[model samples]
Target: MLFNSSGFLFLYLPFVLAGYALLARVRPRWATGWLALVSLFFYGYWNVRYLPLLMASILFNYWVAGRMLAAVAARRRRWLVFALAANLALLGYYKYANFFIGSVNALTGAHLQAWEVLLPIGISFFTFTQIAFLVDCYRGLAGEYRLVHYTLFVSYFPHLIAGPVLHHKEMMPQFERPPGLNAADMAVGLSIFVVGLAKKVLLADPLSTLAGPVFAVDAHPQLVEAWIGALAYAFQLYFDFSGYSDMAIGLSRLFGVKLPLNFNSPYQAANIAEFWRRWHMTLSRFLRDYLYVPLGGNRHGRYRNLMLTMLLGGLWHGAGWSFVVWGGLHGVYLVMHHGWGALAGQGPPRCWGRMLTFFAVLAAWVVFRAPDLSTAGDILHAMVGGNGVALPHGLEAYASYFPVGCSFEGIRWIDFSGVAMPALLLAMVLAFAAPNTQQIFRHYAPCIEQLLGTPSCLLWSWCPHSYWGLAFSMLFLACVFSMNRVSEFLYFQF
Candidate 1:
């Protein structure tokens, strides 16, 4: 169920929260069990058929971790390897089986019909979360194991659908604490949720309107149309993903649990490396800790490790060649950034660095957002003025702005239909000028503050005051009104 949907926002959340609160007071163990049951219900709301698969995964992983913990040093490695392979095998079959078959068919000209394997939602996230837990078991990082706490950790609804990718150490301990409702946490959490709701409903959804037509056009887009589409998508993805992250953190906060921060104004980063450090940070951490470190990381030299890690990271997003190219583009950018640093013995100026990084990211997103490589190439070609510029018929009066006598064969200057210039402008201002949800809520300690560090005292601080409460109420109402055209969160497809 979408967090923004009426059933989830009004019905499911209210019922679960009230039940948990009442149960925790009298029977704490029952409350924990209640949470696990409700979380499973939440998952099953998407597909009843997959509910058993999810439960089986949790049970299997819990048993594997227990065995790994009990085994001696000599046998533990074998157990860990086996557990990792099992997790990967499950993920591969569900997520990539058809992708692999299609690729093989194309290469060998075989008539191998692909199987209709349904990928369980969040399979990538849960599998990786379990794999990390198994590794921690081998490394002696994880402590005592309990079935109830382990079940809650893996199945918690907020981060389960899409995640900041929880670690066993970060979450299992929280399940042991007595659950209760905190007024302060509720206020802050609700405000953050409203902000995220505004972003998704108010910003991201509208931006999709502008982006959709451009990407879907059968004919080549004009130069202006191509840019509008690209920029619209860039902002669309930023707000969509960031909004989901905020809502996840806020929902966890409602349960008195703090999820790790996932986004940190990545668009403002001055370099590709810095951008990765800020964007989907938990995934970056996962890759670094589990994948990169085991592959020798920078110990084998910087360039080779960086490229390999990014290539694998890209493939992790989806089973598409476009995603691989998208990842490879970032890898190449990082390599150049490092090489330039080595040659110049200094960093690029801040303003210039940020501009370059933003544009590079913007360009790379074309590949990420495209359905296929051909579509990606068409958009890129138009972006470079291959289709020439032409104003829409009604706005042909402005043709004087272009170079003298530079008329195209058929097209006008640029077609601006379906483009919401005002909304696009507003999105840009918010992205570049405004503080993100994290920065706004930095002082709340709503989640785990230590990992995010202390907020800068100099920036504006917004505590949970009456005025802020009123402001958030209005925002919440606005979001409610927009719910008539409710849409699914973009990350759900992945």
Candidate 2:
């Protein structure tokens, strides 16, 4: 049921879109119901066992929200607290129970058996989405909604699996409007989707191959290997997650809905703070508003709160100490950025800021991609030439940084030596230079709203002309031809 799979691309999507177009004009409710059922089907197709869990979650939250919407202030607080607790308890048990048990077993010599519970797909996303709804309800922000409309919003296929963490206020009204098949919307959505699919199929997937071997559990890659692998993975994730977001937004647009902008050109960010603003932006905003603000964000002990938020945010990504370290590194980066800003009036020069911020991010991503803390340390050590400097090819530009006596003649741990370097460099160029999906379709307001102020003129814009159509059609063909081995999006694991 991967979005890239032919089954989804050809069969499931076509059928769903056709049905919605047929019903939406006169029977918008039916169309909404149709989408809800299809979304559920899409989820269940991955794992039937989790279908009930998802249903139960939706029903409970809907009921709790309804109760909150009707209750007195005191009762509403109780219901909101109860709802938050229930949602978090479910997420914790499924996502963190094993991590907790393992930590306990390691620390105190307790042989606590790990629970065999399988983590449900998109548990973190759906749970957080509902948690936001509950909090808004408590804040008297979330208004009442029919059960059917709520169901569709929660289960909508485009943002269901991986998300921009849709807010009730943002999405509920869209569902209230009659769903229709607009040709203009379809053309724009399809163009955006084709570009996204090309990004994943042509760029992200192949880059994964370049990165995979270097991060093997036993492979202790050297300086050149490490940098190439690290850059490959960094760019890989950039395209993979952003590509998925583009596809999600475009698909939703086909239904005459625009999902919030999730991934802008984060690599273009000149500082860690700017990076957070651009990367997984909804999640960062969630951490800011829901977690940080509630925790007295920048009001009392700003640095302390920032660190705690990042540590928790890192752990939120996965059940690993490496993830914690990843979060912690960013936390430190932010703290330093803030501290420096206080001493000086502003950040470093723009060029210097971009370079420093990139390597800083590159270092953190090493930890994020590692199998464990030990492996992460090993990779970082190699990255700095700790494990003897050697060169398979003449790839080193910073060779003077190495010990003077170290000989670097011939060592080749890297595969596809000739192809790898060029591919990686080209990928970096694309990541740093290419116009993102939003910019490409900016003429049409490709997202829920344009988060970016103006589209960069680095690339051509999407237009209603046949040339645009033909170009997108060619891109579509390229993606389709290249989808020999369909792979799950990297964010799907989260």
lDDT of 2 by residue, 1-494 (tens): 98888998999999999999988877767988888899999999999999999999999999999889899998998998888889889999999999999999999999999999888899999999989889999999989898888888888898888897988888999898988987557766777787778778888888887788878887888887788789999988998888889899889988989899998888888999999999999999899989999989988989999999999999989998888999999999999999999999799998899889999999999999999888888889999987666665564665787667455675555666454556667778877888777885665532312212233311222332325545666688888888899899888878
The residue-by-residue lDDT of candidate 1 on 352-436, one tens digit each, is 9889999999889988888888888888988888867754444456667766643444343233453356667888998888898
* lDDT of residue 168 for candidate 1: 82
| Root-mean-square deviation (CA) per prediction | 4.8, 4.9
The most accurate candidate by lDDT is 2
| lDDT per model vs. reference | 0.82, 0.84
Segments of candidate 2 deviating more than 4 angstroms? 393-412, 417-421, 444-465
Runs of candidate 1 exceeding 4 Å displacement:
217-219, 404-420, 443-465
- TM-scores for every candidate against the unseen true structure: 0.93, 0.93
Candidate 2 to truth, TM: 0.93
Per-residue lDDT, model 2, residue 7, is 94
